[model samples]
Target: MGERVQTVIVGAGVIGLAIARALAQAGREVIVLERHGLIGSEVSSRNSEVIHAGIYYATDWLKTRLCVAGRKKLYPYLESHGVAHRKIGKLIVACDQEQLAKLSGIMEGARVNGVDDLRLVSAEEVHEMEPHLACTGAILSPSTGIVDAHGLMLALRGDAEAAGAMIAFNAPLEGGRILDDGIALDVGGETPMSLVADEVVIAAGLGAQDAAAAIEGYPAEAVPPIHRIKGNYFALSGKSPFERLIYPVPVHGGLGIHATLDLSGRVKFGPDVDWDAEPAYDVDPARGEVFYEAVRSYWPGLPDGALAPDYAGVRPKLTARGEPARDFVIEGPETHGVAGLVGLFGIESPGLTSSLAVADHVAALLGYGKAQ
Candidate 1:
């Protein structure tokens, strides 16, 4: 007979750890299952670790709501937990006159989403703020910042462990079946075991769909398709030209190849979206050629050979290329017709920022609080 547990959180990424912490703090006996031996080896630590200001998403969308709510909780949590972070702000620049109207439109949308701190700046004002930036106009998002992603994940893991939550590393959720009493999960890896959990949360980033399908009886039609949108990064060799993060107006699939800094003040630009990418991380040097063109649109002072292929990350997008963007799908029992089961699909971008709030919502779905 397999062991019985109160809850099993699939994937020990930021979202899973956050959920484990919340549920454990709520006094639920929780277990977090991770395929990797260490925590947060995938989506949690990849890409720009920016604390978004809830500006880019739709006004009434879950992305905006959770991001806004999560950002509010995250700053205080980071401070009290002693995590390294910076409120260094961000700029959404319009590099040419043609992009100015769109810049203002983004500002208006942001204001509608309760991003009250956004300020419109003229070319002269932007130059004063970022000397290396050449823009016709810009939106100064003072609340946009960056955090130590690894530190944040560790903090979440520590909190979950402190609350009596156990994490099983190298424990992948292979396959399972829905039972009347509980969901029986087959744990795969070395020393494989079986676990019948009263509740399960599929927060497995790119593998979320497969995890959900493994549980026999989860609606096949409900599982959203996963698109591996790979975004490549290029690290700068010389001193960082800008002080704060600099963003171009968003492209179709991503926030563009914006300049983001780590806590050490090192600049890395990237994540130019690759629609037809496999689950790989190799950064081709030839890709740097495209980065040079994209980056020089705003910072024309970029010197040749300054960029070196750094790393790449793939986001589990719900939409295919050319389709309109979809909202974050935190599917609970009420929607999926599976009791005590919640599957999170397409939880990209603002996902790290919204981790805590998403945890709260997951708890609510499991009968803890109101889902808001």
Candidate 2:
């Protein structure tokens, strides 16, 4: 017989932390199981850290709804909690007249997704804003910004802890069994243990599918196939040439390789979608050759030998290669026939920006519909 707990959230990444905070603040006894000693050690830490403007995803997607709503909630929380962030804004540039036509559609998509502040800027306006940029035109998203990812996680953890959520570090979800009333999870760590949870949320990002497949009686068919789509990045050696984030027209599989700035004003490029790459994080220097060419298409002044491989991240995509991207999967009992179990899948780029709202959605799935 395992000890019974009120709620258990697997994974302590940004989404899990945010969900834990919400449940705890709602007065639910929450326990978070983390496989790593440090929070956000995997997919959460290694990324561009840009706050998406809910522009790219479809108008009806959970990505768009939650990202727009989460961005609204996130800014105030960051300011109130003293987290480091900046609304430095972003530009979706068009390299040619054909690409310029795409910008209008992008702006319309953004408006449909509740991002109404985007402005279609002329090439002259683009150069005025970023002198080094040589785009034919661009869509300026003022609500887009950057945040300290680790800092935001710390704040979420703090709030959850203050509200009575306990996170067990190095506690991996080995497996679990579905019970009559709830679910019992087998967790492995320095010391293995089992806990029966009244509710379970699989917010394991990259490991979401594995986590879902492990639990006995969890619908195997309901667990969506995960594609390991990798993106590689490169950093600029010198001072940043742009004040704001720069982007190109949306490409297949991703929003194309673009320029992103961290909160410290350091510039980096890429996350060019590597469809056939292995599930590894090594950034091949040879890949920089592709980044140089892609960046020069919009920023022609990019000096030679300036790009150096920085890092890479893999997205847990639901769709296969060449298929259109899918929406966030917030599967609950209604959809899966498994009471008190919710699985979050395909949470990739806009995830950080959508954490808070996704948390609320997870809570709603568990019958706590109101956001606390």
Candidate 3:
């Protein structure tokens, strides 16, 4: 609103905020623009907040690399910043002989992704760890854990601000024009004004497609379309009995309705995947019917009516239903021919865990190393 910034980030989600912190730490003049009143109001806030263990993605892709690198970087950052989190571990349980047969391949995949410490535990050992869980076998991933996403975002915001980054909330970006010097942004408000930036990064998540269309000469069609995949969760009424996070074998669309504990030890289950044409955040209580059937598969004694709709999060999926899942898409000058512009799409699931690594990658893409 005042003057052009050296760098402008067009979203204040976790990904954007982390990049801001990284760039600002390098002493760049940074300004973060957020359409919402607060940071992380979209998909960043509405997620499982599970720090992934580098599984489920093909080894060569960005998701696999960033997730693996991010998992290694996240715990140290959390501890250094005093963010609340737990290394409470995760179990990929095999409920039947068919799923049991897939455990070896899953382990092999984890190994390929550099996810060490994955142990194939017997059903007897699983029962010893989680008394009520039913399973033929399970893979123990000690690195997988839960994080306080809000707290982590706060720390990143504080660090960025301390490094002289200015964050402007409620400053929705209307559109932009590519000028000879740089991109000029048309911002909305009571007194709308145009501001120029030497560089711009669009980490707008689900809104990325619209953001891409705003930039001249940028291929909107090449940017993969976003599909809203809604995942619904249910909170357990009483105190949690399980010590570790309990999960079932990975299903086609999502990780099965797994039991996850917050840092406070309150238990919740779910995130069963449902594809929708329009993105909606409504959490339907009726979905409890499907939840009971799915959850009871792992926790047989789940009391009737103990589970209630707690929350819902939508995933910005690059691939549609019945298609193979795709990797993270980070578009830069080489791909789009727009120097100093980077766009990120299909960043879901492991996004929180991969925040720092993703930021580093974006920084590299922006010619930060070359600038040095």
Candidate achieving the largest lDDT: 1
The TM-score between candidate 3 and the true structure equals 0.96
**lDDT by residue for model 1 over 237-279, one digit each (tens)?**
9788999999998999999999999999899998899887676
Show how many residue pairs clash in every candidate, following the order shown.
Answer: 0, 0, 0
Q: What is the TM-score of each predicted model, taking all chains together? A: 0.99, 0.98, 0.96
* TM-score for predicted model 2 compared with the true structure: 0.98
**lDDT preference between candidates 2 and 3, better one:** 2
The TM-score, computed over Cα atoms with residue i paired to residue i, of candidate 1 is 0.99
Number of colliding residue pairs in model 2: 0
User: How do these models rank on lDDT, best leading?
Assistant: 1, 2, 3
List the candidate 2 regions with Cα displacement exceeding 4 Å. none
Error of 1 at 131 (Å): 0.7
Local distance difference test values of all predictions, in order: 0.92, 0.91, 0.87
> Between the candidate structures 1 and 3, which one is better when assessed by TM-score?
1
Off by over 4 Å in 3: 370-372
Which has the greatest TM-score? 1
Model 1 spans > 4 angstroms off? none
Q: In angstroms, what RMSD does candidate 3 have relative to the true structure?
A: 1.9
